[model samples]
Target: MVPKQTAEIFQILSKGNFISSNGSQARLHDCISHDDNFRILKEYFAHIGYHLESGHNYYYFSQQDETNTNMEKKLEQFAHFIDVMDFFSCLDVKPVTGTRYRVTQIAEECFANERLRQKIFALSRKDKLIDKVIEVAGSLANGGFFEQEDEDTYKVMDAIHYLETIISLITIDDDGEQKNS
Candidate 1:
């Protein structure tokens, strides 16, 4: 039998929002990551024209489309979002999709590491280290790449659909050169 919150789960996934395993709310995290619950919900979701997608302790929605227009738009959006995700993924905290981070910690690192400082300084698009990091995180958040936990911390989200979309459009050469196909 399908578990409780079946409608709620469908609502969350249908909109392309992710239900992360490490979601800030413990109950929410547990609900989506439940082994049997997820499987049951996954089967239920298939009837509504969306496929339930699983990530590292997370879940999202996906739809099949063969048109290039929609695919290209998704790729364009994902590319920018991916760069921002990379910036956060580079942090020492190793923030999981639902982990919290503080601006002070990143700023402290900037002060100590010359490389990080230089990288911060080199960002002509941003002025301060915290802002630069926030800008990156915010961009990803806006693109649904990650979810904002608070003013400082950001939680990684289950946006792997974006990654899969981008990867499918890219081609690799024998020498390891990547090009858009």
Candidate 2:
């Protein structure tokens, strides 16, 4: 039999969301991370087409038979995430797990740095600096890489390692070619 929280786990991971060990859903993370739960959940989900996958302190679902359209859409979404990651990487506070960020604080930084301001402008079309920050941060939050602690503050989630892993796997050739290793 599956764990009691199986429904709750499915509710989140089925939608492509993650349960991060440090996020508000940490309890769910614990439920899934319990003894043998990973193997149990993986086998259970495999019967239903979703392959339960684990990452650095986080869990999500994947499908083996994704269509071409879905693959294309995912590639496009990953491209946007690359830009979003680039934007966050330039900040004084890196997006390590459990790191907290304030929109107003980031906006202030952008206001003080022309390079950051330009990067924000490139990422978002919002007229206000704060809104641009919000848009960028919201993208991460929506993707399950960050969790909003409050209206203005967001905390980085361990699921961010998913992005970091993917980015790290990519290699650039001497002639400017991008290769996946």
Best by TM-score: 2
Off by over 4 Å in 2: 176-181
**What is candidate 1's lDDT per residue for 1-181, written digit by digit as tens?**
8867777777676667776654543465587566787777777778776888776556678887569898898777766655544445566876454456676687787778877666656542786777876776676565555677778777666564445456567766679667544
Pairs that collide, model 2: none
Candidate 2 lDDT score at position 15: 85
lDDT of each: 0.65, 0.92
* Cα lDDT tens digits for candidate 2, 88-164: 88899998999999999999999999998888999999989999999999999998999999999999999999999
Off by over 4 Å in 1: 32-35, 95-99, 107-129, 142-145, 157-181
Worst 10 residues of 1 by lDDT: 20-29
